[model samples]
Target: MAGKELHVTDIFLAVQVEAIVAREGAIMAVEKGFSNYVIESDSLQIITALRTTTTDRSVIGLIVEDTKSLMARVTGEVTTHIRRTANIVADCLAQFGRNIGANLTWFEEPPNFIIHLLFEDCN
Candidate 1:
C-alpha cells in the first residue's frame, strides 16, 4: 500500500528466515539514512508485483518502482521466500502496525519489543 500515509519504500529486511528474502526489504535495509520503517498488510501483493514482469500494473506498481529505486542505492542480493509460516516475523510487524492507531517509528532499528518478541528465538 504505497501512499502518502505509508510508503512501501520504508520497509526493509531486518532478518531472513529462509533461503530467500524480499528484494524490496533488502533494498530498503541497505539504504543510507533510512532508520525508521513501517510495513503494511498485503505484503504478498507487493512482492508478487515485483517478481512478475507483466505490464498489468496496478496500485502495486508504485511499490515495485520504489523498490527498484531503493535497490539501486543499496548493496547485496535480494532474497525471495515462500510460505506464510516462514514470514511470521514480518507478519507480526504488520499486525503491530494495524494494532496501533497510526504509523509507528523505530530509531535506527526496530523496537526492542519486536526484537525480544520475534527475533530472540532465531534458530
Candidate 2:
C-alpha cells in the first residue's frame, strides 16, 4: 500500500487532489515494476480530463498534466467516474487519511482497519 497525507489548504479541488494521488500511486507502481494495472478514482472530472489528455493552465490542469506524464512513464488504464458506493475501500482509506498525520506511507499489506471494507468490495 502507498498513500500520502495532503493538507487541505494546498489542494485546490477534490478532483485536483485525486489527480495528485493518482499520479503518486502511478509513480510508485512504476518503481515497483508494475504493468497493465488499473487505477480507479471516483472523481469523474479528473478521470475525464485524464482520458482527454489535454493540458491547460489551471491548477487542476497542471495536476492533470503531471498525472498524465507519470502515467505515460508507466503502463496501465485509469478507471474513472466510479460511483462512491462502488468504491467503499478507497473511500474508507481517504477517511483514514484524516487522522493519520501529514506523511506519505507505504506498506506491503493492506491497512488493518479496512480489511472488512476490502472484503466487502470483493464480495
Each candidate's TM vs. the true structure?
0.49, 0.76
Tens-digit lDDT string for candidate 1 (41-88): 234555455456664255445546555555545444342435677767
**In lDDT terms, how accurate is model 2?**
0.68
Q: Positional deviation of 100 in candidate 1, in angstroms?
A: 1.8
Query: Model 2 TM-score?
Result: 0.76
- The TM-score leader among the candidates is 2
lDDT (Cα, tens digit) per residue for candidate 2, span 46-75: 777778845756667776787677778766
Best by lDDT: 2
RMSD of 1: 9.1
For all candidates in order, the CA lDDT equals: 0.45, 0.68
Clashes of each: 2, 0
Candidate 1: lDDT over CA atoms? 0.45
